[model samples]
Target: MSHSTVSIIAQCKAAGLRRTKALELLIDTLLASPRPMTLAELSEHDNLNTQCDRATVFRLLQRLTDKGIVRRLGLHERAAYFTLLLTGRHQDFLICTDCGKIEAINAQCPVHALEKEIAQKSGFTGLYHELEFFGTCPKCSV
Candidate 1:
């Protein structure tokens, strides 16, 4: 079965979400962005304001997040950022405390074995996890 797909509208339809301008714009923006973005950043997106207002964006983000089409990343105490939950893609983060810069690692759970062991010991089934490492990035470290 072939599995490479790129249409966010199709992806939302498969997820049982109706395609709307706000949803489409948000999905398109998130998919194109390299890093997660805060609400202010999203509101200020070059192409987004012409399509939807800040409130519309906020509501769409909530709905997308609830539908598991998007992910809400609590990067720091200041603001929560948003990213898409695309198929066949996963990333963990390395945040710089000094500069507040973020680096997304392509690694998917470098601790799967450890997670399995912990699950067995704790008698938990269907275990899942979230891992984010915060430290000084190379630029900040130097």
Candidate 2:
């Protein structure tokens, strides 16, 4: 198994969750998705043949979130999406309303520089930030 998968399994185990059918379904669903997915979408995946209830999905999401295997995006007060990323390769996201696409933007991220400036100005250290930009994609513009 891939290191991330192994890590996820280990994390779940450490959190008092067993490596069971539900966990396997959760992992497979997250890996297969190219973009962040909401719990509703994940639970509805046909291929999983998942018998686990919504509560199981929620619990697994929480465990994965704590482990950093998934990054959470709060779209609104009511809904959030969980996206997969390689560890340490964190980047902001741009969600396209038209095509339901997600684009990662990392080049020349001002957030990095801003953090440095903030630290220099405030005499603080060891800080980071999360940034996400949402808009209609190119195809949607036309």
User: What's each prediction's TM-score?
Assistant: 0.71, 0.65
lDDT of 2 by residue, 1-142 (tens): 5577777677668867778878877887787777778888887887444578777788878877786566788555546788765555567888765555666784767777778889999998756667888788888998
lDDT of 1 by residue, 1-142 (tens): 1132246667678878777877766776777788998888898898698888999889888877887777877645657778877665667777777766766877657787898899999999966665678778889777
Question: Model 2 Cα displacement at 65 (Å)?
Answer: 2.5
Q: Kindly provide the TM-score of model 2 when superposed on the true structure, using C-alpha atoms.
A: 0.65
Candidate 1: where are CA atoms >4 Å away? 1-17, 106-108, 113-128, 138-142
Give the distance in Å from residue 41's predicted Cα in candidate 1 to where it truly belongs. Answer: 1.8
Instruction: Identify the candidate with maximal TM-score.
Output: 1
lDDT agreement of model 2 with the native: 0.73
Candidate 1: lDDT of 16?
Answer: 80
The candidate maximizing lDDT is: 1
- Summing lDDT over every window of 10 consecutive residues in candidate 1, give the lowest-scoring window: 1-10
Taken over the whole model, the C-alpha lDDT of each candidate is: 0.75, 0.73
